[model samples]
Target: MRMLHHGQASAQVDLAWFFRVAPAKRGAPVLVVCGSLLVSHTAKPPARKETKLTAGHRVAPRKVAGDLLVSGKAYANPAEYGHSRAVRVAVELGKWRKELAVFGDRVWLPGLTGSSPSEPLPFTTIPITYDRAFGGERFAWNPEGMGTGPGERGVRLPNIEYVERRITSPSSMPGPAGFGPIDPQWRPRADMRGSYDAKWLAQNWPGMPDDMDPGYWNEAPRDQQFLDGFRGDEAITIRNMHAVHKNFEMRLPGLTCRAFVKKTDGQLIELSMMLDTVAVDMEAEHTELVWRGATAAATPKLRDMEFLFTMLEPAGALTPPTGCYAIFEALRRKTYPTPEEYADDTKQAAKVRAAKAAEQQAATDKVVAEALTYRDTQMAQARARLSSYKHPSVPANAETGRHFSGIAGTIGPGIPEFGADIQAEMAQNWKMFAELFPSDDENCTWTRERVMKTHADGGDMSGANLSGLDLSALDLTGAKLAGANLSGVNFTDTWLQKAALSKANLSDTICKNTLFSSAVMEHAIFKKAVLTGAHFNRTQISGADFSELDLTGLNFEQCAGAQVNFSSAMLKHANFRNCVLPNADFYKAKVAGILFDDAVLNKASFNDAIGPGASFIRASAENLRARGADFRNAKFTEITALRCNVSQSQFDGADFSRAILTRANFSECKLKRSNFDRASLESADLSEAVLLEATATNVKFLRASFEWADLTGTDMSGSNLHEAGFFRTALKETKFVGCILTGTTLAL
Candidate 1:
């Protein structure tokens, strides 16, 4: 669960719930004369795409630079980002500048052509929209078809290419979102469907060694016990999550409890797990009283419940436990009987059933005697015999035309039309009466609340042709929405916790801060969608297509994201720490200062990512495709940049402290002032490295390539430079502090 240097992970996605909602009420039809799966349904209106550079098909060299899409206020449609124009955006950071090159309708980011200029680099994200109408999903939502939003069709995203240029100033829009002064809307829903439940605890916690055995008592620390059970791995997530106020126990029969969870390794930890049985709770009046005859009547009335709570909590870091007494009050059944009382009632029920059975048997005997008297005189009619057996076998069914074993068999020749039918009716009546007053059989079953499954939408959409619906802030909490064509739906601020959104066409959807916690968002697309603060926490987001989307300022710290397509994404200042991002595409992405600490990003791609001064601290980036990354002065402390394809990267003034660069390919990269202190670069390919004024204290460069490297004014104190190639390299003013140089080639 560590970060990779410049790679993404690959893992299979598990299926969760998918939900959908109806279209929006307001807004004129903005989509004109087109059939797009990613288009929304609205009242008929003029059609003019507000985004910049829409393409009719998946264009070649996917990321064109000149005209990047601009995000602004929400206009007429929720799916649209207003004021999008094809303008060349240039960023100037400190002493670097990166400019977008434009050509007609085809716009391109700085590094779209897989080429980097030999200059100081500035960070920038250039968004491009598709022209073709978007298609529908699981097949349509893969890495092969990345960056293609709702307006475009059949677009393919390629591996990233970072633009290497000079920056003069940071090109970030600062401050809070323009929707007024920022305040977290604490919407504590009283409805249980969007809340918490015990089932979540049972499913998530299970009987792991970290479970707490808090027995039922008058006073027991339930909430404390719950927290104690998940103090290890899961507790880390809770510590970093959004805190909330809630009761610890079941307030109703069916309730769903939800608390914001913190991400761990780019994924939700086991601690943020929850039960989803009672998603919503109803009033007490909804639970009706039942009378099992007059002798047994039960009502769910509230009574005062006082339980003593005890918990095992640490007094301090290493202090003695301080056991204290506290009172907890609860509302429970007013007159609920214990097990002993219920058993006594069961005995009474048995007596009543036995008396009724006796009365029915006597009546059956009298009828049989009367029928036998006229049997011989009525032309040899079969005498009707009343069954008086106790505890009969299973009753046979006439429906299947088959006789089953261990069941009662009926014996007869043919039809006895009129009188026999009448007798059969009477026998059925007698059976019903006997069942109502059974003979000494009393069974108690736990009463469960019946869940209502209803939704509000016009016309059954299960098989309807629908598109272009604005489903912003939709409340389909537990609805099943798998395989639905969600081409043009706007799911802004929607609550999809534990819901399924798998294989849905979410192209061009605005999913800002949308809650998909534990939802199945696998293989979903967000091309051209503004997913700034969306929470896919702990959900299966593997294989999701996020290419060509506005993923700027997105914080995906510590989450599972294997094989997620982020090719050509504008991921500036995005935090992707400790994530599982292996085998994902980051082809030509404008990713500056994107955190990737403690993540498993093996086999991920960053072909030409423009990551200037980005952090790779404590990351493990194996087999990464970082062709021309601008790692100038980027922090890479204690990182495992092993076997990566970092060719011609700008590593000037980059920090590589305590890093493990085993067999890493850093051919032709800038290495001026780039610290390799305490670094293990054994057998690493650093051939043709521009190592001017480099520092290499305690660095193990055994069998490494320094061929033709300019190591002028460099220090290698206390370093192991054994079997290193300094062939045709400059070594002016270099210091070798306490270093070993066995068989090191110093050829001119």
Candidate 2:
């Protein structure tokens, strides 16, 4: 069918010939052919033309009986047409009889075979059918005109033919009258296209054209084929028909997809449409296309179709050919199987899922059962082992007493007595026994008689509580008085040689001229004690506390300990030669003329200590923290004081030759006339320090900071002062002869 513009000739019809073949009954079958004819601009003229004599001599044509030829004109410019070329025509042949019934049931036609004045011929009666004809039906038309029988004269009816023509009239065809502009405020009852589905379409537009179906339209090409189908004047007409159906016939399925009772109800309807099933109102939305146990599985396939529709709509896949809907529906059913097939597959899937779940549960149960069985077996074995076990028997009190008596009897004095000389030899055994096991009730109140007895009884007065006692001029040689509480006691001129006085508490005690040589005084508490002229040579005073005491002229030669705390004590002229005093704390202690020669004072803290003229020759005082200490005229020859912090201290006339003072912090210190010859002071901080007349010859002052320091009259000859800072320093008469001063920051 050729589509034509609006108001153009859509079809050709012969009323006279239609009346002859149609049945003579109301509602009788009558075919009305509605053809869509496209009028081309280059159409040829008609093949034949009727003479004027043949049209004028005929009796005045009655409007009711003759053929009503409705023709339309086409413009040269198709744009001026402003409508689709597809047209549809409808004629009610039954209605014609009702209108012309007043003129009798039958209409007569006069014969025009010959012109004879003498003999007048009779008019023939033409039977008119009272049949109803609907448009959109196929009908066959005879091309040959009505013929006359032999010896019977009759006028030949004109034959209707399909023709294409172009009209030159500038005036275009106006729309049918009595139609006004649609209301601008009109809106659709529902968002049909947005929430489009088969049920929605069926409810909102039951008579929707099969071509405009979503299943068909969504798959149609948006190219030339879509343009040709829904183009021109007919587009609005077909669109109007769709709108009328949506507005009047179809029910609103709400605006959102969630409005449906079942979430996938809309999807199922759409899928049914794609499967070529006629859509009807379902009892329950989900009941029409039952997936059995496969609704979830089938939803994705349905969504695929929805996705395809979404991709097509924006691309002008609106109107498509009628047969394409069928083709697409067929293809969709092939790709996604039917709902019955889907339900069958879902049933099988459900069985498989059930079987897997059951298998997993069975495995878990088996594991639990085995664990319980193993636990029972282990409990049984434990019970059997416990039942067969035996316990050792304990001896009775009488039996133990008898066995000890028999052992004593074997060592009893039942043999012949020894001579005087032999007995003298055995007397030494009593002395040995007394040393091994002293009297437990000695009271430790040392009278001269008790002291004589203690000396005679191996001098084992250990754990003696002799507080506030005077043991002056007492000789405790080779005594085992360990762990004794000798606090506030006097030991003037006492000799404690080779004594095991370890862990003795001698706090606040006076030991003037006391000799503690070869004594194991480990962990002894000697805090606040006066030890003037006391000798600690070769004493094991490890972990001893000698803080806040006057230990002037005291000797600690060869004294060894883990550490000794002499903090806040007086150590004037005291000797610490060859001492092993690691981690010693001498905070605020007076060490004037104190000797620390060859001492291992590693990690010693002498903060705020006054040690003027103190000697530290060859001492290993690594990591010493002696801040604000006075060490004037002190000797530090060959000391390893690495990373020592002696800042803000007095070091005037102090000798530090061959000392390793790397990374030392001597900031704001007084070093007048101090000698640091051959010292390693790399990365030392001497900021704001005074070094008048100090000699630092051949020193490694690499990366040292001397900012705001006074080095007046100081000698730094042959020093490696690389990367050293001397900002705003007083360098009057300062010597840097033969020094490596590379990268040094100096004041201009």
- How far residue 703's Cα lies from its native spot in candidate 2, in Å, is 1.5
Best by lDDT: 2
Candidate 1 local Cα displacement, residue 63, angstroms? 49
Q: Candidate 2 versus the native: TM-score?
A: 0.41
- The lDDT of each candidate is 0.47, 0.54
Rate residue 103 of model 1 by lDDT: 15
Off by over 4 Å in 1: 1-466, 746-748
The Cα error of candidate 1 at residue 513, in Å, is: 2.6
Residue range 213-250, candidate 1, lDDT tens digits: 21211011111122122111110111000112111111
For every model shown, what is its TM-score relative to the native structure? 0.39, 0.41
Measured on C-alpha atoms, candidate 2 has an lDDT of 0.54
